[model samples]
Target chain A: MAGTWIFVEQRDGNIRKVTYEMLSEAKKFGDEVAAVVFGKGVEALAPEFAKYGADKVYVVEDDVFANYNTGAYVAQMVAMINEFKPNAVLFAHTFNGRDFGSRLAQKLQLGLATDAIAVELSAGKGLFTRAIYAGKALAKVEVAGEPVLGTIRPGVCEVGDVSGAGAVVKPAVAATAADVYQTVKSFVPTVSARPELTEADVVVSGGRGCKGPDGIKLVEQLADLLGAAVGGSRASIDSGWLGHELQVGQTGKVVNPNLYVAAGISGAIQHLAGMSSSKFIAAINTDTEAPIFNVSDFGVVADLFKVIPTLVSELKK
Target chain B: MKVLVCVKQTFDTEAKIELKDGKIADAGINLIINPYDEVAVEGAIQLKEKGVAKEIVVVAAGSDKAMDAIRTALAMGADRGVLVQQDTAADEFARAVALADAIKAENPDIVLAGHVAADDGSSQVPTRVAEILGFPHINVITSIEVAGGKATCSSEADGGTQVTEVSLPAVISSQVSWNEPRYPSMKGIMAAKKKPVATVAAAAADNKVKIVEFSMPPAKAAGIKIEDEPEVCATKLAEWMKNTVKVELK
Candidate 1:
């Protein structure tokens, strides 16, 4: 019987939503699903995993695991994989997940697929589908080696509740301090009530045509009105009009939301690769010739400064 | 300190991608240094200008055309270049293995690369290489400061910036905000021709992952276009959202 493992990512003991999504997806493979949670005070979150089809929960709690240190996390993960001997491992394609997942694949000499939108078992092997060429194309990949590793893009898979055996297993791995070669000096979290760009169902994005920070504020205002996430194109990011975390492009976060609104954004191919998969796309641009209109479900040719304020008022009414 | 920067040649960001027979059609396509890698190169150059580095070496694994990108790096002030000639079919794992072998030979104090290749969008090769070499890596670094054999960096995370400090001999993948790259001047271009770019055969490495097939995403169908006054367009959009998209509006 195949065994599947999900790396349950958490911060300050709060489990990330993607972990539940991965757990739910892993159960569909008809394999015994186990969740590996590594952080101080994470054992309390095991019941949450069990609610999402995790048959067993492995907890590695230590002070060194309090922060995200690459060496520490990879070492523990490698140890866990070796002991569990799972045929497949899944992770969320977040900053920490991508970093640790890629390293784990190398350390174990296993096949890895990152940012996968879908995964299926074919011929007794895991097949992954991921976007390539800046979202212009999709590639189906087959992992050749054992212990297939894949990172699922956030918000791609649906989260479901499937109860499983609420068994907890504490794997006896060496309790050594994480061999951190780096130090995390500090972190400045963005204070916002809006949804995360990658996880939001509705996203409102702006581009160079936003002109400046004031224009981005308008975009934010609309997002606030709709209770949506705010994102920016590469041009806006490069111009320092938005934070890097808000960038949505080929090189940035790939978001597939229920609704995507592009305001003052002339769609570059790089930008299109990130949001083209969104269910409903609406483009607002002054330039009629902007390439974004080609793929938008609704196109409005007008000044965004005038259009956005009017839209906000209309939504209010 | 010696710095090694890994760069890749990719299609221009604005170029329209066309696929023919399940493969990218690259004929007559304009290729430039990957934008993020250019930022990495600029980071290395800034370190050199700050007297933190004795030399900077730029490396890539690609065909002869990739040499142009290496020369571009040299013109932008890299000391030398190395090209690992390999087939384009190599997956990210194989490429990372080949690059790790080459990087181990150089033994530089620090290694730099882009967070992700715009063409493939895998964002795995550099991290894989770092793991293979047993080196700690930090990705999406927005800014870096080197002093006293330790580097302090600010990297982008989900809705936050992580300030990290790592010792020398580590690998860092740069984000777009790291630094602005300089263009090649006439003198720099002429000098770049004189700089040595050594070509070596890529090491034979097994591909752990293979792409079985490639196809373009389904084309989005044409939608409604409204060229009217702002108020009318706004009302139309609101109505469409309420009726068609059915999104929750508070």
Candidate 2:
């Protein structure tokens, strides 16, 4: 029972890619790596977890899990943790995951590290590293005399394929649904054909220099051309030119993409903290002294409006 | 309805980090209300202005300096304030316990806090308080409306927004830009001085997550800047992206 458990997050019955990444990483740190998934119509996904090295897939299928509810999910997870008594329980650092992860830790009276970018095995315990000061510094975290519980940040771990024969285990959850305290009024899923901002390899963004919504459209065109995601600086978001979901900053979504192209954004410390970890950065702005150039691998100090079309056409080369 | 807003004082988002003896140097640093917590305060003020909320009580746990933030929130429209005196060195678990105890004494109808602390980046305290109080929580919320003893909230979720309704005595954490925070006018600032802010000792709670040390990330190297014509720059950039970066450009 002292194995590792990774909470699998799913949307529309499709397993989020981050789950596979976490499961694959968990294999190296635990004797047995298992994935616990809660949702309706997810039994077919148990086999998919095996490909990522999960020895067993713990499935909790019910109508109450049709969508994420804090009360319903936390109650079931507490029961499972108590029954299995796993040494390590990892959760994806998504919205729902972060919300309930702390709750579970409190209910179980365990210690937890939030948004850990890396984890290692320390005497069969977890050594978690997370960012603090809005990514200005790194904090090495250890929960003293407690089981390792943490929310794993996305885009850091490598995906592994141990090829374990996925054994599906539908553990009997003694927790009843009567404790649920929420009612879903409506769930308007954001419908966008573009790749998700966090998972996309390329993310093109604009800032205050975009001046208005029209400039962001050009940035979107470039993102669409590259099959990338569109994002904006806090300045652009504050102007109401873009939705909060598309904001990339300390207070918004932290993205670690392969290529991040920033147009017109004078890289503030807040904006850089979110995308500074990007593998390769390119910036286009008129100011040669712009801070964005410090982190960019490539820089073009020219008018973004003048350069975007030419860059688009040249990429068409 | 009684509203409780949990606030935290953090370094100004624009402040430069300086480490002395492996700890952040607080001297000469400008401290302000966390931008996200300010959003929570603003959300509460809006609810009161709409006639939906009757009174708002702001609370914080820290050294006496935190009283400044509580005063700021009061000026913005909190009815009264409570300061739970404690060293801020404690982890989210300890902080949540202290805040929850203070909250229990009041037994508010609703609780609001920032989704995450701007300093530790731990998005835990608010939801942890929700658990300690046995209240349902909806976090990372962009908008929240309360009526008929229920809170309707729009939260930012994985793929999109999820609108949920939780009964009274629930927890809600506000996201940045949910609403523009108001400045403390001179008149409001004067009023805040007259407002009663009580101080209470924090109940002892254990520190679960201890930080071994803090180190600044390595500074990025200076990069090459091409200030040539648009056409030439574009051509060179496209070559670098394809050949150097190896990004598959469609």
Candidate 3:
């Protein structure tokens, strides 16, 4: 009687890409997958979840849930889990997920696994794999709780290939006013040309070798041509030449893209810990001695200025 | 106004870390205040210097050896330091619980901490601390302005920036943009010896998460040279993309 649950994260009543990825993976285990979404007028987004392989969509329309409230979201999730009695739950390893997951795990007295890159059905249950040590290693996490909870890194799992197969929208039986302790006054979205870092398939990151903020233009141009997300090393971010969201290092965003292009980055161990998991790495650096070259699938020792422009032009052709 | 900043001691990011029997090796590795936490400390001091806050308190969780780090912060202008002795690995949830308990005791107008520890790369602690305290929280915050029991913070999000206002007593994770943290002066280091530090034993942590074991990554094969000339390098890259890696060009 244990079913799989996916928290359908939404903003302005629209489904995010991560929601689809979670449901898509959940269906592989042949578990009865359900998505929990909270917001007024969000029932419209339920079918979208279905298209991505959810069995049922749990819609909780409440004004209090309009914006993200740290206290209320955690309380609602904790209560919903107790009511649903799920065997496993998957969440998008996002800011909100990071904020709420651990607390829910604690209240339920269940172990929480975070930022997992992949989850698979093993034996009768599921096993989650996550990148650890700043992306230097992979760790397979086994949860001790009867019901396992994991936050999946976005973009790691593919979108649903089987379309229009999921079930109809249903009201979440567990959502209650008692668990709502906080209210959201407003909700703001990040304004970027590309998708979320973890959700992006291709990431182009720059390092101190970019010279200054203006140097990001070259990286951005290439990313734009490839329709990829842009990232930076900790040094570039710390130097105020790039935004923190674009940093890919030990303390920065952990990304596992199909392709990662690092330009001008020397590839410090900390920096490598973030993007080393990337399936394909292409490094562009003037210094052939840069450590980043050691792990790169392809190394271009020439100036990124000369190499990137040429690559971009060739790709455009 | 009063602000509390949580500081931590971490191996310098530049240092090579070795795992010894599932734990970090205690080699001759030099320990420094986590750079992000140093930003938090600097932010707290800047607030105090601006006369926006009457006092700033710095808290840390570690062994007795961490007293030196606390003293370093005190010399940088933190009014007092609190040390929580715990043997637990500096994981996110555990540190959040301990920091939350300590912050509650102080009852500061705002609580500050780094978004993540550099070593673990788990950016869950600050937001977790915010949840445990039941406060509105913001991450990657660069600037903070307080007035009338409300603080407006500018957060660097996915693409652009977000300007948000939360009431006092909120939690914020400091970003590198907070300010250029000042270097500890010789005078400050000397004055730190006179500052007081209170160490308390933390309650037994209910460690829910467990690491099965730690292992290093497989050694990368030696990199192949992309030939000598620029055009040849480009050709070689193209050939590798088409033949070996089989990456299709758009």
Candidate 4:
């Protein structure tokens, strides 16, 4: 019987937190779960994956694997799947994962489900559930064949700790010419000190009601005080108050943080779809009738200009 | 220069979505163009203004009923529109494949789509189309530039933004923040009638995926307790985090 495989995505030399979450989620479905790590800093991540319930870790460490090249990564994934069959493959629902997961599924003639919110084993196979139509609808999908691939949304699966012994298995397949199809001369990452919006456990977002960019800066201050990432509605981004990087909407980023604090956002349906899955939501708006309050777990009926400073000061303490 | 942008129609976000008999109820909901495609259209139009692309063609694969969305794109400054008419119940992958075939036949210089349909948000359509067309593809592109037969796309990734350069005849899935799509002006709305929109039979697609059932998400628990004072509210929230959710903040 094939075991579950989790693709551990890393950048530079740090193991992303989502890898651990995927391992934690994988352990629930299969008796033996393994990890496939492609990049330079993977050796250090093996122990972390094991601490998160990985039975074995597949390490493909090479200079070529250091930077993300879609053609090469998808080729490597196909080769790995062909060699060591797995019942399912899980990936973080990131840009790289979204690029590779769908291509890998299409190449392998398999089904892929993206942004999975929940996963389980049913009737001797793996099953995944995800939201669709923005957050309007939920769909459950069952992957019937071997190597069922799924890319899970960040913050959806709880990161669990399973401190135990883990074995680091050297890459079973070596990188070949075909594995390095695309070449990258250099990579320049974004220069932002804030945590990524999708990965952040807490998010503070502003909307059209913020009045302008200065108000968004206030929202950013509150986010920083609370150790949260900054996010914005489509309107805020369109108004040039926030950079595109800070946008959270159906077509923007899907963030399911522990705490989602919305200020001056009326909670358009499109905006709510991206953040409704958050564990706890708090909306502060001057308009008591704003739609954001409908889905918010907690709401404050006061002008954000007044309430935000008080909240920020209190949280800073 | 020729550009192709894929568009889809989805329910407005605030529409009360209801599932009836294991399928999405077809309420008389107000339909708007998928927000992502609006970004794509905006990008295409911007390219036109830069003199890099002259003609923009918007295409969609759906039932005959989808002609309305095609008209909507025509109103948005597309030089022309094409509808790959198909029956209802078409899966996303199949629609993308068919649309890809149609686009390939047209041989546009750049093909762009909204990153994903808001209704489904599967985000697989463009990648599938790219694979089928054997062209370089990028997702979540916030910025773009075409020079010397190559396109440079800047996309938002998990921790940071990423940049990639691909040759022309590539596929790009646009994000909502890519550009502010222009609203139809009175002049453009009036000129929309002059644009030519063609309809053709959809190419055959082997759809392997199926939607068994769809349901609204589970309701959130009862109202959250908030203290009148901000300090008291924070304390209560902290208590709930520790006791109810078991998440202890440092």
Candidate 5:
């Protein structure tokens, strides 16, 4: 019988939404779904996994996993995989997931497909589809090795109905301090109530046309009114108008939100690669020739400084 | 400190990709060192200049043409180059194994690589190599400082920055913000010719994954355009977003 394992990612004791997203996707592979969580005080989050379709939750609670270290996490995951021998392992394509999952796949010599947008069972094996050339093309990949590993791109799959058995178990393997060679000195979190850009339901992004940081403020206000996450194009980030973490483009974060709004941004191909998969796109730019209008569901030719305030006010009413 | 930088040759970022018969058509296309990898090479050069690194070696796993990319790194001031001869079809796992094998022989103090290859965007090979070598790995590092045999760096995370310190012999993937890569000058180009580039046979390994097919994304339909006063445009956009896009507006 085939078994599927999903890495349940958590931070500061709260579970991330992508874990459930992966669980929902894992259920479709016709395998016994398991969720593996590694962290201190994460056992309480097991019931939440059950709601998302986990047949069993494997909790590796230890102080050694309190902080996210690639070496320690990979060691623990490798140990768990060796014991369980799951046919497939799923992870969210987040920073930590990419770090540890890729390493685990390498240490075990397993077939790994990263940033997969779609996963399905074909011919009794898993087929993963990923984007290449900045979302211009899709490549379907099939894993030939046992225990195939994949990292699912966040916001691509939907959360399925809750109908799991809610069973939870503790894994025997434990991570030791010696397993870690790196130490996290500090975490400086961005103080924002807005949802993370990658997982946001809506994203509002500005480009060079924002003119300066002040103009980006206007974009932020519009995003706030719409309850959306704020992002910037490569031009804006390169100009220091925004932080690199907020950049959305080929070299930046890929977002597949339900709605995306672009203001004063001429959609470069690189920028389009990151947000083209969004369910709905709205573009606002003064230049009618801007390529962003080509993919937008709705387009407006206007000055963003004037348009943003108007949108914010209109939404207020 | 001995530092090894892994680089890849990829199409220029601005190159318009064309596919023919389910593969990228490369004729007449310009190839450059993967931009992020260039940043890594630059970082190593900076470290060497700062007297923190004693030597820098660049490595790549690709066909013979990858030497051009290595030469570019050597021009940027890497000491030597190693090319692991392999077919372009090798998957990330196989590439990592080959690279680990090459890297293990050097026994360097550190390994540097691009956060992700511009072509495939896998972001896997370096991390996999670190795992195979049992070394600590960090990705998307913005700044790195080596002192007292430990490297402390700030890396980008989901909602913020993470300040981390890893022991020597760690693998770090360079972010674009790490450092600006220097351009190869005429003098540097001449010197690069004298740099040694050793080609090594790559050990064959089983590929875990196979690309079944490749196809272009569907064309997007033309959108509705609105040209009106700012107020009118805002009202219309809000209406479309609510009625058509059906987004929940707070």
Candidate 6:
């Protein structure tokens, strides 16, 4: 049955949690939620989608599908969309999803919206609420067209366990060189024991108050202690203490973690735009009048170097 | 090799966003070249400096003000520019179509733009242009090197960096850290005024989506602050994080 479709995101055959979250979200709309997963040897995870309320699982497997290639994934998705004619398609706003969604929308000339914090479906059309001007404001966009396409921001929607029809359908299609415009040579990952910043439930971030890498290391130690991700303001990033990927701001990644801990961050407007939507914000700063304190649910006027270590030591108790 | 750089003028990241009558009030707002697009312009200029590219053409498609974006690119060291005059507001698809229409005539070996615009933040026009032109597209790339009719690029991926080899005549979008943009020299500023910028009318397409409403995010709930010794504050903060925030600690 043609209905809402969720693009399953996976890395090395392990399905990302966002896919389940999207499926759970699609189920709430009272539509037939089918998950389309791509990659080689990912059939075993098909049933897992069912547990999260996927009515059908369309698996496209090929050696070339293991790593994400924009054109290849776009072509496969276009073929599937044409065949199934789903009214709506949802994807996680991860790197692959954002890249693939744009190209797919162009190839098909479909109305597509990206980075939606909230979404609703009416008469097969998608109404998406997305942050504009880098979270300074929110806009409600009416993506009204056939096969409405959109990408959901991470951590906004809750994961649900509603069961659905768990039929697996392997599409008899393969991606060749012509479908791929670029060849992936290698993937080098940053060495980090913490969670991915955007998808993390808890984020511990450093700012200018973080004097140097040593201070950031303390932040990282706390992140590791609590299984949270580490983030930094543009100041710390520009200071060369952290990578750009860890930056959270208007130019950087916007995070909506459940709990965001800021150490030495002054919470400038640009910086606040990124993490203001967080469920609960806490700040540790030497300045009691820091703007970060204004947005924080709890604040402490103390030096992070002393407070963070003490907090770590005490939490260990 | 020839490079074509696309740029757009948008509000600075710090500009206040004020919506009036279902639109953003443009009164006294400072618009500059999108920070990311400046990176793309810098990348193209670097390619030109290396003698690998003979010509760098900057292109922009928007209102007349978009010419400022092209002029800024020109002052930064591009050889020429193309301004596709699109006075009416359109979706990313239409803008891409117009841009691709302009790009097709140039047929450069490479096209570059920002990973995403600061205004709409759609991140579509360049990729869509690539699709329309039947070229490979890579976005938010940190570095690129060209040789033997191919581009080797390192792009930002979730949790990792993906290195890819794209064929020539590809589309590349730049991340902020790609390169530092240079200030236009006085000589460059005078030279940009003399730079040739061709103007063309935009192609038409139906608008795709309508913004129903714009609203500010809800205000943050009030919070508590504690000023005390590190030991006491740490104890209270940890307790607040675990009990009040209800997040896991250790």
The per-model lDDT (C-alpha) reads 0.88, 0.87, 0.75, 0.78, 0.87, 0.88
Chain A vs. true chain A, TM-score per candidate? 0.93, 0.95, 0.90, 0.94, 0.96, 0.96
Question: How many backbone clashes are present in model 5?
Answer: 0
Model 6 docking grade: medium
Q: Write the per-residue lDDT of candidate 6 for residues A1-317, one digit (tens) a residue.
A: 35888999898887888888898988988878899998988898988999999999999998778788887788788877777789898888887888888788888887678889899986658899999888889989999777898989888889985988879988867567578878889988778878899989999999999999899989988998888999999999999999899999988989999999999999988899889999999899999888899899989999999999988987777
User: Residue-wise lDDT of candidate 3 within A4-72, one digit each (tens)?
Assistant: 889876767656788888888888887788887877787788778777877777777776677655556
How well is each residue in A1-317 modelled by candidate 2, as lDDT tens digits?
37788899887687778899899888886478889998888999988999999898899988888877777888888788778777788899989888878988888766789888888754436778888776777888886433578998888787875756679999875555796788878888788988888878899999987889888988988998889999999999989898889999788888888899999999998999889888889999989899999899999998888888888888887
Across A200-224, the per-residue lDDT of candidate 4 in tens digits comes to 9888899987899778888988777
Q: DockQ of all candidates, in order?
A: 0.76, 0.78, 0.36, 0.42, 0.77, 0.77
* Model 6 chain B worst lDDT window (10 residues): B202-211
Q: Chain A TM-score, candidate 2?
A: 0.95
Tens digits of per-residue lDDT, candidate 1, B1-250, equal 9999999999987777778887878888899999999999999999999999899999999899999999999999999999999887788888998898899999999999999998888889989999888887888999988988888999988768899998778899999877789998999999999999999989998788888888888999999999999889988888888789987875
lDDT (Cα, tens digit) per residue for candidate 3, span B1-250: 9999888888777677677777667689888888788999999898998899898888988887777679889989888999988774645557777777887888988888876666665567666666667677777778888888888887665434667777778888877667888988999888888887787767555765666656666676766756456656655665564465554442
The better-scoring model by TM-score among 4 and 5 is: 5
Q: Using lDDT as the measure, what is the rank order of every candidate, best first? A: 6, 1, 5, 2, 4, 3
Encode model 5's per-residue lDDT on A1-317: one tens digit a residue.
Answer: 46788988888877889998988888886778899888888888888899999999988888899878877788888777778778888888888888877988777778888989999753336788988866767899987555778888888999998557758878775579988888899889899989999989999999999999899999888888778999999999989998888989887888989999999899998899889889899999999999999999899999888888877776666
lDDT of 2 by residue, B54-73 (tens): 99999999999999999999
Each model's Cα RMSD: 1.7, 1.4, 3.2, 2.9, 1.6, 1.5
CA displacement after TM-score superposition, residue A26 of candidate 1 (Å): 1.7
Q: Which residue pairs in model 5 clash with each other? A: none
For model 3, how many clashes? 1
- Could you give candidate 6's per-residue lDDT for residues B130-205 as a string of tens digits? 9889999887899999999999999898889989898989999998988889999989989999999999988776
Point out where model 2 deviates above 4 Å. Answer: none
Off by over 4 Å in 1: A122-124
